[model samples]
Target: MATTLLLAGLMLAQSAPAITVEAQPGLDQVGYQALSAGRPDLAIERISADPVMSASDPAALINLGTAYARTGDRTAALARYKAALTSRDRYDLELADGRWLDSRAAARLAILMLERGKALALR
Candidate 1:
């Protein structure tokens, strides 16, 4: 978990705004569409329900993190980010502004980490 968080932190070190989630077609696309529609719960359900997505889609993983963070469950959000880092592909996320609960997903997580000043995931 620490390794995943560390990698995400390192990737985020670039400081770019990741507002648009790079979504693939199928369940992943559905998930992104759901989130864009302001139905994070449905987004989560759609993405998490797909077995292939849980294993392969980095975008879906990031979207899941966004959903969790949006719903105010930082723990869940951190877990989703950790899972995203496990993907062999290094996906660069340039999120769209205000398209998510916060302006940027990773930025929001960073801010939440700062405000809370804790979380093993943030370490």
Candidate 2:
């Protein structure tokens, strides 16, 4: 009976849908691509050069936080994530796997993952 239950759980986990979170268009998108390419340094450079990226939008902040987290800068990452959480901007963030999330919801999720030492895997 235990073996059967284990197999059933494994099958359920495997059948679970994948979630993909896309970056905001433009610079945020570029930064996200850089991060995905494993170049967190490049992501930081691109996203940090302009304040406009973070000004009314949390997308860049979220990306920046992820990049910082990738680079092992937990403090900076948390700061960015926190800032993103407070941003007034609202938009639907579409994931690569076709799921949509509110930008703030994405930010909150990112924060939880970072706090738990998980790498931010959003697109």
lDDT of each: 0.47, 0.59
lDDT of 1 by residue, 1-123 (tens): 111211122122122222225343333452655655555688779778877765555555666766666666767766666665666644334322212232124434544553453211111
> Can you tell me which runs of candidate 1 are displaced by over 4 Å?
1-18, 22-30, 92-123
Identify the runs in model 2 with alpha carbons over 4 angstroms from their true place. 1-30
lDDT string, candidate 2, 76-105, tens digits: 988888887888766666554456666777
Structural RMSD, model 1: 10.2
Which residue pairs in candidate 1 collide? 18-94, 18-95, 19-94, 19-95, 19-96, 20-95, 20-96
Clashes of each: 7, 1
Q: What would the TM-score be for candidate 2 when compared with the true structure?
A: 0.71
Of candidate 2, the 10-residue stretch with the lowest lDDT total is 1-10
Residue 119 in candidate 2, Cα distance off native in Å: 2.8
| Highest-scoring model, lDDT | 2
| Residue 40, candidate 1: C-alpha displacement in angstroms | 0.4
